[model samples]
Target: MYLISGAECFDPSPRGQVDVLVAGGQVIAIVEPGTLNVDAEQIDARGKILVPGLVDALTHPCGGGGEGGFGNRTAEIDVETFVRAGVSAPVGALGTDSIGRSLDVLYGNVMGMRTQGLNAFMLSGAYRVPAPSLTGDIARDIYLVAPVVGVGEVAIADHRGTQPTAQELRRLAAETQLGGILGGEGGTVLVHVGAGDSRLALLREAIEGSDLAPSVLYPTHVNRSTALLDEAADWALRGGFVDITVSTTKELIAAGDITAEQALRRLLEAGAPAEKITMSSDAGGSLPVYVDGELVGLTAASPGSLSDLLRALFADHADLFPLALAAMTRNPASALRLNAAGEIREGTRADLLLLDPAHGVDSLMCGGNWLLRHGEYLN
Candidate 1:
């Protein structure tokens, strides 16, 4: 048993000055400060801020978007990177470059990370539909593979996309929806909405005309274009999740385009439900700026951007818990249906983080294992 005390807890209950008690990789209890009935190691977190570890639902932690393997493909995140960033959970997906990407690879990767005591899950396939998968079929993979929780990175409007027809979109959504049903998960045909004027009409039509729930079809990178974002906002109002990519301060500032912070503001101002909004780092994925069908500049995505977005939002005077943290934690968990995560509470897995008052991660615990303490990793 362990007692983590002297911190404000962001458990959705949002209790201040409480102590968390963890036993065997789960939050055994949460109580008023100084209240506990067990002998345990102690972590004095006085004056520190405590928050549920963040969740990245749409990261390409499988290694993505770049050519070359081993040396060139980005390595999957270690426990330390996640802990240091206050991310206790990562929901991975593959991106545009799909060679060497497979369901088996994603499955094995998620298992390896979970074994090291982080809550890791993955969405199978990549930017093309008829998406890449394992077990030979999407539904079978979801049922047989523990980590194959969903399918996506299905590119839509980008030049890199398959430019699938509406019939193709409906077919894919139906297939994915069936996979989720048989697998007891939110089998989302997670779409990669793009910057074209076509926007998400195909998705809207499928949801309206079919039996699939609107919540099951997630659209990421909505902030990639201004007009496309307007479509995303409308989709959110109709009950779908929109994922904005995180940015470095420089990238966010220079973007002059929509940012996660600005998107959140605009999303809320447009009456998009706060909980319906999420943000992903798009880490290890590529951010390419194109002109006249030419690549002008390309920057590799980094896991570091997750924390960077939070810190930048702090400067904007936004509320951290309900707004920023939800995008990182609860929203993703809800979208992925990762049980007992995205919030800190009794009986939940102890996937929690301690942050400085300014919200920088200071320590992290995933599944009750302290991978990082005072900024150091046990692993």
Candidate 2:
């Protein structure tokens, strides 16, 4: 049992100053300060702000990269890195090199995170058509695999992608929808929007030419280019979710593309619904630089980028900070259909982060256990 006292709570919706009580891995109660009479380990959060633990909807936890070669494959993420990034729950997926890494290994990484006191789930496939799955069938993988909530990081409109046809995409979305219905999961087809000339065209065609709802397709990395960002805003206004990657560098940002903060501002200015936008760190994935169709260099992404983005938004856009925070928390959870997460409420899972005066992660608790305390990793 743990008690967090006198923290300004943001159930991701701002609940003012309150004390939160946790027991048996669930948020059992939240009341006015000094109202709790329970026996538990207490943390003094008088000057801190409490927010729902971040849910990273897209990350290469098992490892991403490989565009440069086998030696360039990124390393798997550790539990400490996630805690430091204020992420209590993260959804793992495979990126460019799914063939070299097995679904079994990805599933094992998910389970390992669970044992380390984090709530983790994974997508079923990689960035290709006929998505590689443990059960060979994407639908079966979702329905039979408890940890698999969707299918994704499937590439489209990119030179690195499989160049799947409209028919192939329609079939994929249909199968994923059926799997979601049967498994009671989100069953989202997480499309990796590329910087190709045909950006988002295939996804739009898939939605229009088929009976699949627009919500069935979730396109990520939409902030990679100005044109793609505009299209993403339009897509969001039309009731689809657009994910912006926070793992960007100055070089990428200088090339006429916007940062995650800028993307949020543009989406809002363009009349896109707040709930339709999400932000994630493409953690442990490769951020490669392609010059004239040749991969010149690669750098690894970190989950820490998510935290940095949050602090930047809070400082630069204080008025819209709450809404931007939702992109990191509530919106992604809603998009992923994760019911018990993304908010601080009684009966929901006790995954929480405490922010210090500098807006850095001071402590983190997942499943009612403190993983980091006073800016230190407890484990």
Candidate achieving the largest lDDT = 2
Q: lDDT scores for all predictions? A: 0.75, 0.87
**Using TM-score as the measure, which candidate wins?**
2
What lDDT does model 1 reach?
Answer: 0.75
- Please write out the lDDT profile of model 2 over residues 1-379, one tens digit for every residue: 8889988788888789998999998999999989888889888898887999999999888888887789788889998999999998899998888879888899999989989898888998888898888898988988888888888999998898889998899899899888888988768888998889888888888889577877888999999888999899888877889999989876677775688888888888989899999999999988766777666777789888887876776667677778877898999988877766788989989999998747688899898888998888998
Candidates' RMSD to native: 3.1, 2.2
Instruction: Give the per-residue lDDT digits (tens) of candidate 1, residues 1-379.
Output: 7899998776743577899899998888889988686799988899787778788877776666564334456656565666677777787787777666766666777788788877888887778867778766777766667777788878887777877776777777677667777877757767887666777887887677677677878898888667777788899898888888874335434554577777778878888888888888877675655566565555557666776676665556547545877788888788766676789878888888887756577888888888888877887
Q: Alpha-carbon error at 351 in model 2, in Å?
A: 0.4
Q: After superposition, how far is residue 319 of candidate 1 from its true place, in Å?
A: 2.5
